[model samples]
Target: MIKFFRNIRQRLLTENKFSKYLIYAIGEIVLVVFGILIALQINTWNDERKAQKVEDNFFYDVLLDLKKDNANLNYYKKFHTKRITYLDTLLTYVRNPNKTMGIKKFGMYTEPLFYTVAPTSYETTFESAKSMGEFNNFKEKQLVKDLSQYYADFVQLENSFSSITRFVENQFEPLMYKLPEGYMSEDTGMLVINEEDVQEFYNKVASIKDNRKITYDYEIILKTPNTENYLIGDMGRSYTALGKIITRQEVLTKLERALNKTIKR
Candidate 1:
């Protein structure tokens, strides 16, 4: 192509047709400029296509994370719901002057209170995208906003769990340790038995103590100051955590729907 253009210029120059040569020269310049613009346009299109692909992959990963988060939150919801039931039972027994509960049953109910699971979040894709400034380039601004809000809500849920965990550690566990019947082992510094699995716990304890029975009157626990108040507070916290889990599930559903629409587009 270059050789053909060169020959045409040489022939025009040799022919001494100055005016025609000038017109041809202008046309060649215009052709060169047009070709450069087309090349640039093609390059721009390729870059945009690559960027769209990256955004798609990011959205796909985020969807997977949201699914995992929903499942985890569901488990937490069930757990808190069950814990609230135990707390309600304990509170009822303590509140009534005539009601009484056995030590074994008390242990079982209170045992669940001491354990807690923090709300889990799967934000790896979001975090990575944010750190790399990928979100700035994202075409779906609403989706990006929704993702930010969702993760922010996750942090709040975690704070809710932390409140209950702190209460158990700082207040509830110490009060329980002060109760009768040696709940903690003097040997290994561990709970002597598992309240949830009473049969297995009894068997293990019996093997160690030649069929000895662990006994403590529930009345002693009931008489302890602030015991009723602690149960109330714990129940409230459990309810709060459950509410957060429920709210998060709603947010997850909305985010998931948005993501599905974006991905389809």
Candidate 2:
């Protein structure tokens, strides 16, 4: 194609038709410029396609992370709900002067209270994307806003758990320890052992046959300074954690929907 154009130009120059040559020269320049523009447009299209692919992959990984987060939130919600129920039971037993309870049964209820399930979040994908500035590539402004808010909620959720943990360590656990020996036992079905360690745990518990030595005295426990207060604190903290989890789930759902729309595009 270049040789053909060159020959035509050479013939026109030889014919000495200066006006026609000028017109032909302008036409060639216009053709070259048009071709360059088309090439540039194609290159731009390719770059955009590649960027879109990267964005798609990033969002897909984000979706997977969100799914994991949702599962974790569900688990925490259920766990906190059950904890609140146990705390309620303990509170009721302590509040009612007419009610009586045995230490063994009380131990079963109180054992689980000693443990705290801290909130867990899957933010690896988000952190990676942020560190690399992938978020800037996102075209949907609303999606970016939702994502920022969604991850921010994780911080609040963690703070809630920290409060619960501090209460357990500083007040609740110490007070419970002051109780009579065997008031709370390790074999009270509170420990969650892995499947592989289940048999070993059972063997250890079985070896300690005479574990229950103290009997529950409702009046004594009720009279113990701040026992009811600690129980109430525990319930309140658990309730707070539950509320955070619920809110997080809603935000997650919104983010997931935004991601679905962006990924489809």
Candidate 3:
């Protein structure tokens, strides 16, 4: 092609017919300009293709992360449900006034109560943090904004959860909830809690149980009176951050399907 153009240009320049030669030179210039424009268009298309691939790869990674997060959150939801139940029973045994008559005293459940039924921060904490970071760094601005507000709210909810956990463990345990009262007796006494005092124990343990249930329930998207204002407000602001992530994951799968289809085509 270069040789052909060079030959044509030389012929036009050297030919005796000046009028024809001038027309031919103008035509050669137009052809060169067209060739340059075509080369530029091809380069621009290649650059866009590479950028879109990078964007797609990042989106897929975010999808994988969100999918794992969803699975983990589900597991923790089940786990906390069981833990709350155990704590309920343990607290009942320790605090129940009427049910204490047994070979072993109600004191048996006191230590286990705190250990087995203690409130815990579930998988949402880690997931929220990861999701927030991903949202912030995403190449897609629309997705970033949509996810950012939601995740911010979820993080606030998680923080309130942490606060409640700390409140129960560090402060409330000492003042409100008492430890197992024990007196070593050489003679065996029927492990007994007088019926009159049962109500008092029930009331105390119930408060703790209610607080724990309220906090744990919030994590699972459950509603309750104890729902902290900070968490509620933040969560409201976030606009279902969790659902957004799930939606994005679903979209990513769809995009993958479309990409696969195009590849086959």
Candidate 4:
């Protein structure tokens, strides 16, 4: 192609009649410039196609992640709500005078830990974060950079939410488990419990509750003359874990918005 153009240029210059040759020369130059522009446009199109492919893969991953996060958030929410109902009933058991009638202590409804601790369900968004790398070679590298930073910020917020939830969930073990013995009877390895012994167990219950308090040493729940520390497990507001899962749901909503805009589009 180069040789053909060169030959045309040389032939035109050798002609004495310059008018016809000048027009031909101008036309050839125009064709060459047009050809170069077309090649550049094709290159740009190819790059865009590659970038779109990367974005498509990334969006699919983010969609799956959001769905998982949403499902997990819901599961934790349900877990927390049921726990609250049980906790409220236990509170009633604590305050009622009928507890002395040998009514079993509020152990049955709260005794799951005797058999097994309720397994915590976990949801992860890190897969979406990792998948954004599909766009690493994209012409618009900023797409990946921006998405990665967004995910980082989101995950940090998620961690904070988890910390709050841990605080709440941490309080639950003490309530469900009677002692190191859990909800089981120490003498018989049975779950049957009596509240007559439970009033006597006030200090023991407080001891268990106290251990879960933030101020284990300050001695707040220790009733008069019974100075035994009631503290047992990590302290937190009862619904704190459930609340964290709820907050994560909010984060998932935000993540979905981001992914749809950045990836799906």
Off by over 4 Å in 1: 180-207, 210-214, 223-225
- lDDT by residue (tens digit), candidate 1, 1-265: 9999999999999999889999999999999999999999999999888888889889999999999998898788878888888888877887785876765567667766777876668998899899999987789988899899889877788889999999999888887876654442222212222224345544465355433455656676776767887888888998998998998899899988888888844
Clashing pairs in model 4, backbone N/Cα/C closer than 3 A: 165-241, 206-230, 207-230, 210-231, 211-230, 211-231, 211-232
By TM-score, the better pick of 2 and 3 is: 2
Residue 239's C-alpha lDDT in candidate 4? 58
RMSD per candidate (Å) reads: 4.5, 2.8, 13.4, 10.5
Residue pair clashes in candidate 1: none
Per-residue alpha-carbon lDDT of candidate 3 for residues 159-211, written as tens digits (9 for 90 to 100): 53454455446633452232222221212222222223344444454344322
Q: Provide the overall lDDT of each model, using Cα atoms, as 2-decimal numbers.
A: 0.79, 0.78, 0.43, 0.49
Give candidate 4 misplaced runs (Cα > 4 Å). 1-15, 100-105, 113-236, 261-265
Candidate 4 lDDT tens digits, 27-135: 9889889999999999999988877776666565656756765775575566456555555654444445354312134334444222211322222334444555544
Q: Which candidate should be chosen as best, given TM-score against the real structure?
A: 2
TM-score of 4: 0.57
Off by over 4 Å in 2: 180-187, 190-203, 211-219
- Most lDDT-accurate candidate: 1
lDDT ranking from best candidate downward? 1, 2, 4, 3
Candidates in descending TM-score order: 2, 1, 4, 3
